[model samples]
Target: MRIRLLGGLEVTSPDDRQVRFTTRKTSLLFAALVLAGRRGHRRDQLSELFWPGRADGQARNSLRQALVDIRRSFPPGEHATTYIDGDQDSVALIVDPDQTDISIFDLKLQSDRPSDLAIAADLYRGEMLAGEALADGMDEWFGPHQNKYEQKAQQLVERLSLALSQPGSPEETACEGLAERLLASDPTAEAAHRALMRIHTLRGHENAALRQFELCKALLKRHLGAEPEAQTTALAASLQAGKAGDLPLTAPKANAATGPKPPAPSVSTPLHDRPSVAVLPFQNLSGDPEQEYFADGIVEDITIALAQFRHLYVIARNSSFTYKGKAVDIKQVGRELGVRYVVEGSVRRTGDRLRIAGQLIDASTGAHLWADRFDGTLADVFDLQDQVAASIVGAITPKVEEAEIERAKRKPTESLDAYDYYLRGLAAFDRTITNRSSLEEALRLFMQAIERDPEFAVAYARAARCYATRKSNGWMIDRAQETGEATRLARRAVELGWDDAIALSYGGYVLGYVSGDLDASAACIERALVLNPHLAAAVGVSSWIKICSGEPEAAIEHASLAMRLSPFDPRLFAWQFNVGLAHFCAGRYDEAAAWAGKSMRHQPNYPSAMRVAAAGLAKAGRIAEAREMVARLCAFDPTLRISNLAEILPPFRRPDDRDRYIEALRIGGLPD
Candidate 1:
């Protein structure tokens, strides 16, 4: 008896008769069971996987039907002869290890023998579970395994091609077949094109080699709207000049000591006036292709670490990751992103061992200022990433910067899945164009991350931030209930991520603005500044606390610091609004009006910014502009009035400041 799961889910009995399940769900269940092996899956888990969004009883019923169908696909068996062993609570697979093709494939992948390697190569007939699409949420659970199998297939190709690419080997001819097959699946694979060209050049087939280069060029132009990387183009040029031996036939191994390290270029006009950087997504060189997510996560972690540096202006991940799967020139990337430096790297993993190679390049001169390689076990992966980030910072500016080192070393969660969910939440939160749906979705994703890892403090902070975002967007339906929840989440974030400036900043901001706990918010933000010192949003929100305390002069300085820390931060508009409040408090009505109008341009419907804009205009004697802002503010939030301001706003310590705001609002046509 044999079962197949790599390419498609199929079963064959001892008699060699193919067995088919009645439905895709049944096949999926059986495949899941077999993959589980000795570890039993709970009935509730299966029900949720197969019938999500259905009523509990209905989901359970559907799972039972799928299980029955799966059991029936077994050979005409008597009692206790089934592959699946199940009680009411859980189900397990009882099949022999040799009876499953995927089990054999895994064994071959782990084995060292060339014979076993060849066997693994033969087993991958096509994409894992070809033509398969699971239920909506099931895809997330299923994708990693699919990637795992696909990675195995790629490893088989690379290993075999390399081994056979050498002279006079019996397996040499198989290299061409493998390269062509890989290219057919992923035509944009520049490496595969190079491999084919190298194979032809090795055999002295110059015509074939030239044809391969032409094919690569056409495919790259048509599909990616670009040319090949410098190495590929150089290889083609060398081959065309009949200097095939000069071409780099083997892939460049990332060795920190041996490779041609770019010398640090002389500093002229620095990348920008301020230290600026773009971090490209690290290439996944981990033979197990499924580890691409881990590579991506590393880049994200490094980006966050770099962003925390107040001295360095970092491009957002959205802008940098746009280069993924594209052939890019470093100078072009610098020009497009307006950055001086670029950090690029590759990640490799073998069993428990891990290797990360990183390079910090001056994008202007394409000169590497620094390059390093880290070797460690899987458990030390985060520490390695931290080292890389800390190293880059030290290379960029070797100052009195222990605080920057500490800032770069913070870890949000130990669980990679939790980190992935948190990133999804961040993406959702980033798109809140004053809409309720995106914020709601962000909350859901953050909640999922929390469910995956309860101690994920950053997720809790982000979840809290969602409520604050809703409040800011005038989308809060139950202010009291939401304020309590927001306060609770923020407290948890501070408790858990005690040293994380990101968590603390979010916690402090929500506490100040949404909970209106001026003292607590001020204290938390002050502590956060001590922790990171460069946290822009924290400084901005700290100014809000100062505004409430009626220290207009101090508030103005903090607001300016916030804007300087991150001029492009979406929340910088609120920081600008705080500056307007400071100006309005100091009787500088003209400056207040200008800053208020600037805030209004960024966040058109922000009730508070709008109120300040209207009030500032009225106080400046701009009656026509004041009336327009007043009308817009009333239309944006009709329920807002003078009496409710006390409950909604942080209390002003100075009576004159409070009176002045109310008087201006009243003059601007806001109801008293």
Candidate 2:
């Protein structure tokens, strides 16, 4: 018998018959244990996570009934212990390596080979436990695992795409096949789309390459209200203009968007260097004509923020808004505005909450650049407006910057060995994922970078950033000494690279987060934004300050915007924490608890998230659940105390807020 949890719950009998449980709670119980992987959960833990509303005795009784249902779905025998095993204390699913697809997928991902990655991609049928609606409580336990599997799938897509881009790889067809399957699930996946284009060009199928470009371009524009990045455009040009005798095999592969694509020899470049964008007024979907003002307000805010980007030419509001209430073609809008991108959306206000959905499109090809939805209480409608603006600007700038960075990296590496060290540091830094060992390794690489190039301000900023990370995570080895050192490095970064956005932003972060100088930090970040308004990290830091400084609403707006700006950013979980903190500070305990759940869902091992969630749940009147969260938090970090929270927390501008925070944590059962 085989257990399946990849798409949905199912058991394959030896006779090839499919067996599935009808009880939703039973399925959740089965999933909880299997997704736990090796760490078996105590029966009590499972009971509470799935049935928190029930009393302890009732919850345990419910768990017993679910377990009965789960066992009945499996093949008959004492083989019951072979599939599911548990004592009175704990329970878990034992994976049969040969029969389980996830085990094979996981094992294959451990290898760096492209073939292995492609094999793993084939096993991920869809979202984990797909087609099943997860209740609120189950999500806190199961969501992170689901995201991890999805991330693994994405990594596979990236590797296979890279393989297809290689000139003489024997697995081009196989890699393309796997990539297409992945794209079938997420059509807007830029890497997979690019891979298909590369595959066609490699085979000398010019028409296929052109068609793939149009398909990608059309989808991106139609869904996102934006266009393909310049790199994609230039690559399409390369495919089309290739001589009948020769093709460019080295179309830039999937990479962290940092730089630009080299234009094809026969193609003419755009007159301007920046991406041009027009912000169209959002449609009033609230069914109330009075909400038209709110919709228009969101568009205006987005326009202003986008106009701040030096690398993006934004159409004036007067021009963009002329098409209001008119069903103008996106392509026509693009031509009229002389812009490459157009932003559009709809707003619906239901009761006390407004839900806003927005998309960025390529005006010429109708390719979607980005799309997302924002939901929040109407009390903070202005904050919601800012979030929409931040999201759109965030979506467009990174890809352009990434292409530029890649181009810079592609230069001969011998003369630029210092930069090589810096690149290695960045790779290591990304691996940190808020872990101690990886962070230390990244710092070592950054140190080597500056040793080779004494003038590398970005390296200094990154080095200083290590201390700030430690500060954020409460991992400071020696608080005062680390803060002083971080300040020294930050000051050096500001002096050495006034124009470098990375240097300024990271430097500003250290100053604000560690050195406790908000004003100075603000100046550095402000200057960095002037240099590159699209620096998502800098915007997030700004939000952090607002959150701790008694401006919860502002912090949430900025944090949410920062998240939308770079959705795949590794540090996004940390930013989500800020959003939760902001809601908690604003006395929106329910919202705070919900966002806290989101942070933990993104990073299940994140300890701070437990604390925030506990505090919120306690304040929200879910005492039993809050106590449970506190127990988990203390198990993760035994030394945490309610009284000492101020040591880890930034000095709040409001004393009352500080008192409330501490009291809530205490009520949630934190020490002292």
Candidate 3:
């Protein structure tokens, strides 16, 4: 029989048919035995897990019965000893060490080398026993182990991300797919998000990068009742602002916004120009910390919805959230956030009614440009959010003709309720990264949103991206099914919302990562950019693809363009890393070293940066520095050997280029 654990739990007989257990608990028992490795649980422990809260006699009887059923099913003499029961010790899965998928997953994860990542990703089936029941005793017993697997999945994703980020490799397509899977399994996983964002951005899908921020914001709001973690938010902001190069790796001081604000409105500033704006965390005027999420959600939704407008250069949710619960002068806030206009608000909820008061401030003069109060029933909450965003958009950009405002007000697809669910789904998806349960919750919310609005192209695109990412990252078991679903949904997104930059970028990114059609990927990303030049996702993805396709010079240029557009973006590491990779591919060892050094400066222990730096040092004949860098790489991933390095690298379009990179690493002393 073959056991699969990536998608749903499935045991197949030799004939290739699924083997169904009488109860899910039995499957759980088997899974536990397999995951436990050689050391199995004793009878008493098994009883507690299988029949918790029961009397000792009853629990023992239950364990005995379970064993009897398992034995009968196995028919010891006829069946292979997949399960072995000991007299007084424990029960274990009996198999050759190399036969089991779980063993393979463990071996890959335990390896300190980056090459094992691909194998690990392929072995993932799905969320462990995805549709299995976790009632009564099984919940406690399996919960911790599930958590452990989820964490391992995340680690493997990081390893693959590092590998794919290297220069001169064809593995990027596969790695990109794996990263997508990882994100699907844990949408809010910072590493997964960062990896996907980097890949998409390089492929010239800057809008996709921005969508990543949206997803992150949605997940955070749903789960934490808060914004994304500071680092993640900053990363997204940096990408959106096209300032990925300028963003610092460490979290900026929470007490103060990071950089200077955009120039104030003046004679030089066009009247029709919507001075970009950022909505900082509103003061909780109601004196209830519990209401903070509502207040923050209001800001986030407005920010996201407004950002969709082609004319508006709204700051990403991350940079805006830096001011959460902090006090600051409006001019200082504007200056630090790099926006000429600022929107500040307060939320007061009373029973079934909510009172939201907001103002648009001219950062240059600290004058109130527009102020309004929205008083309504709880059901009208989302409408109030729309009104607030629309008002702010109109106030800051006086030339924004009424028609333009109306155009901006156009609902995603005439389904306000679906939009609401989409917002809520985004919230859940953003917070799903810390654990498996959260990921499932996020998926549930996304599915709920999709059901409410089947034609919601952005929603479909995001869902597809999520599932594809989950499979790619080894966070799920059934890679083929998840990716297949992603492909279908992404194609649907294009059919439904061809004009939506986000949909195009996200859908195109999924296509490129999973299917390796460079032409299609390029076309989709280019279309997204033409529709929204300021869309950071489009810019980032385009740059990534250029580098992977052996046009490192173009990659650097694209990254530069993205940085200029979104200067305060928080995800600078991605841009810088791409720049470094491009330089490495172009054989600019010195420049590559500098860029890699810059990346390390931002994210000190970033594995990709470390490898890039090592490669640069090796190419430059700085043997000592190269060796030191390799040592660091090895310490981070001990299983990294020269043979595996070549295997993990993305295929180089040029044989000479590939040979050069491999030789550099070999000289730098990668083992074997």
Candidate 4:
């Protein structure tokens, strides 16, 4: 019999008749034995692994029955018994190791010969046990095996792509197929994408190669919100310049006779904690020499506005303006300025009409991230300049952050520095779900960031927010310790980052919520707003502070402004929740419930949204729906009680506001 277990379990008799097990467990057990080869599993171990907590006798009997089922799977009189032999203590599948596809795959991989490696590359149909439904504990058992095989497949594809670099050789064709397969399985496989680009270029299909680069860029952006790596970008640039013929496909790999080869040369790129951007002086499209000053003024204003954001590194006006009135390469400008992003534009005037157009491009890949134009009359030139500057700053800040977050996500965890870890923590914390585990992970990463750089103010600020998240979700254990930690982190953040608007905003919010220090929180957030009024997060937190301070109108207005500032921000749900809370405080129960529903749609498990929806619904006389929301709330926080509201919730500045919220929740059917 021939059995294959690489992709999924498959059994074929000597006569080529297909054989399948009726029970999934039996098939899994059989596959396990096949992987085990001659030295099989002990019966007791197999029994407990598959049928946990069962009586010893019952588990042993089940194992025996499974073995019998495996034996009967083959054709009658084929003596399948010889293939499966074991003493009472252990079960073993005795078959020629070569008969199994996995063994042949391993054997071929060991051979330094290119042909054997090619065969090994073709043998990986997919991840081990592909499409096979694994039982709960079984996945834990199989996970290591799956990871090992997946890594092996990745190695094989990369090795083949490097070893077989000839233009039209059979080995090259096989490498192309393998790279394609790897990409199909993992769209974020940059190595595979690079391999395909090299392959297409070697085949004299330059356009196809360029298209492959575009595909890779889109895939990275769509899935990871990141740009291509520097080396990949360089390859694409070389291809565009028609110099790909001189490019080596890869660093050498182990040859049939030679040993392992040297590593590829590293590409040089600047390392910055925050993404850097340069706003080049806009070209004066108008024929009038007076229009040159207009373009320059607008670019200068934009550079200043962008510099206000703490997370961005905006190039100085003098440096950027040196390229004024000259045609410049975006990539060269980026390299010279040590920036990841470049903003270029043109200003045109036709009689009294003014039109200014701008585009944001990734400096490394030359990919345009955003583009837009504004039209107005030059009647109020300064007003138009301010409007356009604000518009550009607002539009590109979020885009830059998105790209940076994606790049951080793609960085190897083993090599991460403080800033990379902080970015990763930010991404995890921004998840709409707001789950406990994700919050925990965000906290862990932020603490790691702090460990790498003790004075990382923003990291401390975000780490405090993670505790606030846990408290909001009712995931906090050992309340005093967590509360103390959160307060310390917040205080340290504010102390260290007095000039950083983002740090102050995040830290202030955490302090206000956890420590109930409304005055200090308000002062910090107000300072942050003054520092960077266009910052959506600062604005959002300011709105929450307003809600706590009993200024419902100001709260709603700030929340609205925050939303308008970054319409696509991941924290939109929080702003929506803030609006709901302000309306609830203003006693608009129905409207509050509606807004809470909207927030829940964006972030389904947001604890504040759930509470607001339940209380507002009950106040609006929607008892049935209110009870349903309460049921979900209780499921999410099983320990929640009306009596301990102050422990879990932030204190309202007005005592009546707190009492009103408590009364509403009590009426909503929350358990005492």
Candidate 5:
């Protein structure tokens, strides 16, 4: 038996091989059998699936005739059995699983085993039986399946090409052969052409690469009547110019090769001249090793408190803590960390009389910006932390203006108790991912903070964010209810704390994810950024908004800024995922894969990051890898599917961007 699914659904048998059933009802029966796999459809189910409008007796009679035609068209022992019919029971395809090209193609595409690509390539016969006609009823049943298989074939071609192009690969021959076969199937496939060009270039045949370009142009003109995209044109030109070897692979640049060289630390410019700064772990000069935690806590407090200032960019605690015990050069550290200013300090506890020494250095010039010492009793520890934050903010305020500084100082609610609760909630929220119970505890803490002060916008915002996470991760039993509460809390946060960066950022993110209001989310995130440039969360969320809004370049810029601002962020996975998503939307699949890989490295179990990575790999034509990642992602979040992705995904204003994601997932073989 032969099954064709590239264009329309069909089944053929031996002897009378031309016995084709072009009617919609006949085709619908075939599609239903294929989709159901080995499970023979019940007689009632078959009748309903194919002849839903017909009477029960008529539907059953029609199904029986179709089966009889299938068996009669191909005699027994000549071809594999095409149908398995049981009296008063069900019907199914008795053919071997591998006999159906569509099934084989999907299996090979999803397999990560070494020989999968070759298997997938061999199974794709052509463009799914193009130009075939079926009844309206059958068209509805088979159209999507046909398109999906064709897409899967195209994706496999891409994967085969990339896999073959990598240096020192045993599969190089296999990849080249696969690319040739794919091109034969769809002569105008630009991706296949590009892959061939890369292979030729890698083999030292530059002219061969140029010839591939010409072939692409000819095929496009003859078939689709189009030209290669700008990137393709540029690549061809580079090959012609004998500079094809200079093309960079899709990988992150390695760190500096030389040893660490610390430049002089001195203040040449004031702290206000810089957009962002990082305060490394403060040294413990109290002689007792137990004081290390105290010193570290001081740095954490100062970082968090200063991060609240709208004008000054403060590095996150995780990134800053990376330098805890290492004696590093300040200027090199600044350059590597992408910061313009660096703060170093030491804490001394002498019989409860705490003495703290702090120095701010200009990273660009390796000069000291300011140096100060604070001596007070242990009871003044909290005050000392607040004073440090205030001093840093004051030093950085000149970069904006006196009026802006005054306005930033304006408190939305003058309640120190509320502020403390908010801070505690933040501390808990940051650690909420450690365990399921921790998440519940964190939610409770956030609720407590909100209950203490109904006007505490930041607390409400954080609470909403936590709830959103629960819903997104499938931790909540009632996603609709949790999401509803999250939206309400986010709205309240935005309403109550117009000037609070945390409130605006978290509220905007929740609204974007749950409400699908791109414009409102964008406004909130933009406002948050204006309120606090150092707010990494706001910057990261804004980058995603930009991508979804069809502004990939802007999204990349914002995501880069977020990375620079929070180099050691514990949640760096989120930032990396944002960058990858932007790149994927822009059709830069290689870069997207690289960034997504980084995100996965940072947090292996992050579902959102995994989804982005899978999409990136699929777009880049790494089919086997993409399939593997998709399987992992599906296993991690079983609720994911092509039909529901749009609803679950953050809003993308452009239809094309949304389609790109959906198409990528389809090609990646997302499970139904």
Candidate 6:
């Protein structure tokens, strides 16, 4: 007998004669038994599975009748024992897995050989049992199986797309067919769309490739209400620019002398130094199937929270949720997802009480680094979820950082990619206390990162920030040239990083300070805060923008909130300076001077901190000390006189605020 279950249930005799089951239940039961292998399923379990909510004796009778019906479907006089075997306790199908198409497909998928994978691709004709009439509640049991096969098929096509990247290869056409089948199964499969785009581009069908990109974009927006990911967008852009061949789907074969080595498996060698993580769907232990939505919501919240961190590489929720309802090995998941960490959790509810438990695992080693449980009432479920997400992110961030630090130690500088260069630039930027040398190095490094990947938005923003620092310290030799360059970089950052909070934060600050565009700057900063309310840098920048706009109270409140979010933030000096400036604007001279003193202790030579200290001290009648601050500020930057103060400082929105600041500096004996 030959059994096929890919498109639908079909059985044939050795003479190619069609065989039909008397009832749909008998066919489903036969498929179930065949999938159960030689060990078979317990009669009680099968009864509960197929005839749920029925009495034990009645369900057993139904199962027996179904077995009889299945046996009768076979050739008569061939004996029921030939295909079906049972001895009261349980039942078995005497068919080898290799004899069935679905099982054969799975076995072929297990092999790493491309030829075997191609055959596996051919066997998955469509969704498993695509048009079979499942029982009313049978979908719950069947959905996972169908989804699992579909996910495997998607992976198979992507692997084949990368493997058969060459033009005019025989398998390339087969891979295209598999890609289309994947789209038929799931119209929202971006990977399938990307594969088709690349295949078309390789076959010199540029227009076809561009059309596929538009289709992917429309489908994503319609179904997900989101834009395509950065990778997909970059691929589409390359295709549009007629540089499709420059962005190969697979790495070129490496030669000993000149060619680059093949990508590694650590967090997908393409991401280079980035450490990726995935949060699997939290299991619903509440016994009520309805709570599945609650469990999924928790995972989604956690995934979004984790993605807010600029340095973390988080896998999308759609990809992570594919592991739902499966018993997965952590190592295998890590390898398949290209993530170093995996987060899994469970939600259990009893009465009005809720318990959410989560664990962070080092996927490479299967070691649990952190685990915690939160208890709350359903009335406060939203707050409970927020607490869970914050706890998980706060716990795992440091662990990920430690791992990345160690990885950086072992990585060669020659192999540094865009992300690595960006990280190095960030480190240099953080160490730039009052020296132009460190700031210069940070700018160069950031520019290098941008050169390596021109679409890197945050790198552009940070590089613009370096120019902002130079302007603040009076280090620019040619103000017009530097201002124009900073504006260009800042605008590019804003254009490219519409959805990135960190990029928006820094880019907004530079544009406001250097280009005097307060309205546009405020818009970008406000959007960044909306995107990630917990981002301390965005909060800090918003506070500075408020101060520039002469809203001292709002500025002070935002600065305080930023400090609370990151009390020991690397940019603590900047936060303190913002608070001081806000207090100065509010005419609280004593408090302003005190806060400015605190900022100076962190960065003594920062010209703005010195100016704020002098202005506050003079307004509070500390004559000698105020004059000393003025002298120190001038020693740092001789050109910073009251005459040119309007040109040097950030453009103030209120004339009264600017005049008051200048009057205070004049009282401190600044040069005319």
lDDT of each: 0.70, 0.72, 0.65, 0.80, 0.68, 0.79
Candidate 2 runs further than 4 Å off: 1-435, 448-459, 605-607, 614-634, 640-644, 663-672
Question: Which sequence of candidate numbers ranks them by lDDT, best first?
Answer: 4, 6, 2, 1, 5, 3
In terms of lDDT, the best-performing candidate is: 4
Q: Candidate 5 has what TM-score? A: 0.41
**Candidate 2: worst 10 consecutive residues by lDDT?**
258-267
Q: Is candidate 2 or 6 superior in lDDT? A: 6
Q: What are the C-alpha RMSDs, in order, of all predicted structures?
A: 17.9, 11.8, 25.5, 15.0, 24.7, 25.8
Better of 1 and 5 by TM-score: 1
**Candidate 6, position 507, lDDT:** 98
**Model 3, range 583-620, lDDT digits (tens) per residue?**
98998997887888777654455666777888888999
Residue-wise lDDT of candidate 6 within 1-672, one digit each (tens)?
678887687887655678777778878888788767786766766787898999979999999998888766652355432377777767887775666887888777666676787888888888888889888777766765776677667667766766665787767777788888888877878768978888887888989989999999888667645456445666787777778776554332234542333223455523324788999888775656777888888898889988987667899998887666543556667877888889988787767888787877777755555566778898988888776776666556655655565565466999988877777787777775578898888899999999999999999999999999988888888989999999999999999998888899999999999988999899999999888776778888999999999899999999887776555467778989999999999999989988987787666577888889999999999988899999999998888888888766777888877888899999999999
Which predicted model would earn the best TM-score? 4
- Estimate TM-scores for all models: 0.44, 0.52, 0.37, 0.60, 0.41, 0.52
Tens digit of per-residue lDDT, candidate 1, span 1-672:
788886677688666789877888887878788877877687777887888889879998998887777666663356434466778767787788888887898887665455566676666666666667777877766765776566556555555544443555444445455556567677966666776777777787878888998999888667645556544665677788788774433322223533332222244334443458889878765546566777787788778766775446888888777666443556667777777778887776656877776767666655444555667787876776665554444333322122222222353445446656666676666654465787788899899989988988777888998887767556678878998999999889888877767787888777777777777777788887776665666677788888888889999999987776555566767889999989999999888888886775665566777878788889889988888888888887777777766655556778999888888988988787
Error of 1 at 506 (Å): 0.9
lDDT, candidate 5, 69-106, per-residue tens: 55565444654455554556656666677657777766
Poorest stretch of ten by lDDT in candidate 3? 399-408
Better of 2 and 3 by lDDT: 2
**What's the true lDDT of residue 635 in model 3?**
77
lDDT of 6: 0.79
Over 4 Å off, model 3 = 1-448, 463-486, 600-607, 623-652, 655-659, 662-672
Question: lDDT tens digits, residues 1-672, model 2?
Answer: 676777666667655778666688777777777766655677777887888888979999998888777666553365443356678867776656666777787788666677776677667777788878888877767776776666566545555654554555655756676667667777866656776776777776778878988998888666654456444565676666664233333233322452332222253324243457788878775556777888888888778776665445777888776666543456556665677778888786667878887776656655444566789888998887777667666765654344334433676756656666676677666654457788888888888889998998988999998877776566776778988999999999989878777788888878877788878888888788776666687778778778767899889888877786888676688789889989999999988888887787666647667777988999999999999998987876666787567766666778888888889889998889
Better of 1 and 5 by lDDT: 1
